[model samples]
Target: MFKKIKYGKIEVRSQTLVLFSAIYFAFILNLAFWRYILGHVQINNFANFFFIISTAISVVSAFYIFFNLIIVPFAAKPLLSLLLLFSSIVNYMMFSLNVFVDKDMMRNVFETTTAEAWDLVTIPGVIWVLVLGILPAVFLIRIKIKYLSFKKELFSRIKLIAIAIILLLIQVPFFYKSYASFVRNHSEIGHLLNTSNYIDGTIKEIKTRLNSNHKFIRLDENPSLVLNDDGAKTVFILMIGETARDANFSLGGYKRNTNPFLRKEDVIYFKDVKSCGTSTAYSVPCMFSNLTRSGFSQSKARYMENVLDLIKRAGYDVIWQENDEGCKHVCDRVTIENMLERKNSPYCRTGYCLDEVFLEGLDKKLMNIKKDTVIIMHTMGSHGPAYYKRYPDRFKIFKPTCDTSDIQNCSRESVINTYDNTIVYTDYIISSVINTLKKFPNLESGLLYVSDHGESLGEKNLYLHGMPYAIAPEEQKTVPMILWMSDNMKALDYINYSCLKSKAKDNDYSHDVIFHSLLSILEVKTISYNPDLDIFRSCRTRRFPY
Candidate 1:
């Protein structure tokens, strides 16, 4: 069979292949890990240098032992090749994009759409994978492994494992204190461990999904609307933003005029608001749940009733207009208008539609509003590495933008320019929604615009979001939240706009306030409503008209 093949093959012992693969992963495939280690660990003397060398040896030995145990004669080549390919891609993302592949990021990967996934596929990334991942994997597939007798192979594996363990253990005793201190301070180091990081993350995500019971747990049983004395219908729009950080908003003191349109509106901009999670997979569902950021669980929230459910139960016409990805399953029970599926809309292209697509039939929808309603417009705001694609060319107010998805290749100024342009576009969308709402004076109208999470635009070498919340920089957590209420809505709800504006400026807020705030805004009286978390509680002069 080997002689018949036209392509040449390299014959090697199973043990030899495992050792080489382990060394390759530990050294060549772990550039980000080694870079992080070197940058964080200071070498003051010969002893420190020796400790670094010992750490490398220990990592290499550990990989060798793991590979030796897992790689059988029949499965060695395929398994190792797959690992090499995946590790190379992971390494490129970590080293170039500065993204950490933890459980939440893995969840993002699984939940990401094909179009969103393609946005990440850049020329540089393809080249990196071809050179480092594909070439090695192909070479590995062509290699034939020679196995010894069963008893001999078993003894050989045991001997190698013992030697690797000894090498790893010897360093621990000499540098135990150094290791402890390094781990204690830099807990994020584990997220850089090339293959293990993503693999462990994937496993943990899978386990969480499997363990979830998927039962719908209703929160409020007899929730009812606190009807106002005035017979006017209320229309509230909750605009959920994507990848929009407060740092770029002019309303939030950003140098650029990203919120050019929003600044002109009567919107109250909350500058110091944080998100429940750093990624959409976690934050979107979390913000609507009664659970606060610290107490949120994705599995539990998935099956439980959220704010939308409660509001719908309270007799409001709830509709979710999705322009981004599928609402992270939060709109599963609600009436969803998937704007991306709309036929031949001018704002839509092949893969995705711009935020303006939400305005297409919105006027007609607003005109037909008869009852109190809550509409969620989930906008594709500043979602990148294709920030340039999020907005139209006319909205490209910031010039010399980073046009390509390979954002790392662009200058930092170009990246920010491109990102700010998206914010500018978002400002247009939000203002358009508010303007549309303003036209309908008969209906008590208002809008709440809050980002699901923020983005990292080359801050601290971090290109995008999804860093663990514990160590995530403010760039990924701090988001802009804008609230707009028409005069009629304010009068009907007895909400003091001045008081709310004061609260927006002085108080610290997070995604935790969203559920209660929505309940308070709509006057949905239920046992699940917590007055303490409501930002509008103090501002509302009158009590609920139950």
Candidate 2:
């Protein structure tokens, strides 16, 4: 049978090999193509390139193994295409499951699957989950399995299809999330290498450069500008917000009265603050890095050092508190990120908990601190899917909660209202923190709040965060930036406040300034600090040393 399947001069197996090779070759080309999409040189590390190559090899090898072990014996069967299509479905299923399971990865923080997932009581999501898992697997099986029959019957296939439907009923979520992440990460290349995750490896290289650039000021390296009346106490708090939109902020001058509290306060608010990107996956890492959003995504991670790491080294008492599942590895090196976060701990919440949960332990943590403090509170404000999850029950300021993840079921107004309510809660939390600073007698206290990234509440076809940078909406790119400093808290001889205010108020600054701004405020010396990178440092004389 294999002998008759020759085309011109080539045998069937040779033909399959050639075709498979071509697909994988295209995968390699896609790696280069990804760089073009970003319009930058992809200076990926050795591991990144290795990842691409390995992924392509793994997929091809899997196909080969399946074909040789199972499909070759069933060559008489004509169910190959159906099998391939089925596998695509399963891929989607696994992808969904993975995303939902890895709380740190996606919307993994839910205590329970949202009510929207249920279709009538039958659970339409079960059907979806199965389809996501079963289809691709069926295709893969069909491709490699050897089907033999003296005479094949067309009508008999009906039973097979039914069987497939039944199988899909059992395994959707697992299949969906796995495939989705694979594609989302590498689909830009449209190649088989996605199975290997080379794209992420490349992304990591650039992250190093970004982390290296994350600091502009270190507190211990320089004395606090704002001194208490007694002149013996010191205090500093860095409030890292999560997914708060600039357009929704009242202080940032969003037409909506989103941030009424900040607007009223005498805070140094940046009217034109721009996040490096639209998604937390990209933005959080970028915000803590030296590079701008564009620059960080392409640079090498090995070359950078995060601001937090430096603060700890500078002998300041570093603390990391969180009300969110938050970013992975980003906070790994911080002295305090572990003590405060509930990620892997027995914290009742998953990806998101209440803002009050964060506010609950706020006072005891900060009062009576010894050395200068670099406290970073990673909030769970405004994460999507269940937009209402981030705020407390009382702070459900937005009416008609669009608690369902399915946006089509909810009106745009309902979703925004719920999200804004969360933002309002975030503002209240910030206010409480600021108020705490005012009362604390020890140190000059300051609050710098920047959201990890903005989100999409169903604008155009964009559902949530993580839209590719190329097509991200303005809503996703713009973010709220507020610096609340007490009257006495000013860099004594460092730089001009008016200049910093003017620069920050404009939307030109990206995550690049975060490092320098922190360094300037903390007085930590770092070689990576660039006045040009700092929105406030261009006028400042002394530069920070990393």
Candidate 3:
């Protein structure tokens, strides 16, 4: 029985408080973890039932041990309250969105802007936290703790820790095969473990930051531009799209006409393309670096020379027009024009801007081109759970759209419709860029649009992306890549457009192709340029015209 303090606060012994807190966390805070285990592991026999019981006991023991080690006499209630509140939010994210929190996902969380964070907030989320997290936390904070003498408390804690460890270890021998098989097959199960997942992710991210080398390795210091003798200025636009998946695109044979504008344009839509990573924080830098997806490291990539650096060294004026999040340090050395800062009346809103913000003064800039230039326009296309906010009113072609951020509450039809509308708007943005490129016929203008990564909209109960790459669904991996070339650009590189189109249809490509393909398209001669990875290399009639 609990003793009543002066302010009606329940006074309990430290050991009792720790035990109750651990039980609360194990049973209440770990719904997703228990759900995953139950769904994946069958309990057809008594042995299976015993395994489940053992697993539950082991989890509770683990929590008990963890709390005993971390919770001190003075900070016990405050610490438990905070953990409960945070665990609730994490649980909501995992249960509602079906996203796995890993190191890269933590990096995404750290790098997320205020506006981006607000997009994930919803009424249901608040209510869930209030009921399951805040109320419990308030109750925990109001509890008073009665501790024993220091020596006795220490002895008691040590004994309890020992007991918990024995409880955790005793089950392993009996269910060794079950444990081994479950762990081997369901590696992603670790991500479902609530407090452990985010805590592990945060620690790994911090360690990466501490261990990463600050000095950048220069790939090519003296790369040269090998322009055609015709003396026409080459204006290549690299448009980095966000979250636009091929499955929703009409160009890739989706039943929905999500690409009405792109269908009319003579662009080569590469149907089968995979992203470097499932998150923007990983994929954007990985695609720009000379390193292939297998070889890429974000830590190394931040300090290393990217394609933009080589292009700048090769004597072309390079500008990064960012409308999405930060360029992930890919455009660090280049001239960056944050389009979101422009606040153009037609395109700009409270904190974010439309993709059309990139097109505002594009024509004038192209017309006044004084030299060969590469303009990298990063667009915020189809980023959700606020899919309806991505596009304008006119581009809401898909009917009965999901307008709220609580997309879990929305019907499947409405969610898909809302997501499809964003793609349609993206189609308009890309085609508009192509049209802008067409107006500047004197310049050898061309455009390459590739999404950083794809998205998930309630597919297999998964919502937004950031699933670990190894276990990610095809919805989060298969992105759309489109290329548009002017007649002048075709002549400049001696590229057979028909041949490229033919290859685009049947051939598969990934983000690894971007670095080398950009070099090929820009006529940049460097040792880092791998002709083998270049998608346009086979279509070119001649090599670099140096």
Best by lDDT: 1
Q: Which sections of candidate 3 miss by over 4 Å?
A: none
Q: Model 1 off-target regions past 4 Å?
A: 1-8
Q: How far is candidate 3 from the true structure (C-alpha RMSD, Å)?
A: 1.2
Cα lDDT tens digits, model 3, 63-136, are: 99998987787677777788888899999888888777788989999999998999888999998889889998
Q: lDDT of candidate 1?
A: 0.90
lDDT of candidate 1 over 423-515, digit per residue (tens): 999999999999998888888999999998899998778889999899999989999999999999899888999998998999999999999
- Model 2: residues with Cα > 4 Å off, grouped in runs: 1-124, 131-233, 297-299, 337-351, 491-499, 538-546
Ranking by lDDT: 1, 3, 2
Question: Against the true structure, whose TM-score is highest?
Answer: 3
RMSD score of candidate 2 (Å): 13.1
Distance from true location, Cα of 179 in model 1, Å: 0.9
Candidate ranking (TM-score, best to worst):
3, 1, 2
Worst 10 residues of 1 by lDDT: 1-10
Question: Comparing candidate 2 with candidate 3, which one achieves the higher TM-score?
Answer: 3
Instruction: Flag the better candidate by TM-score, 1 or 3.
Output: 3
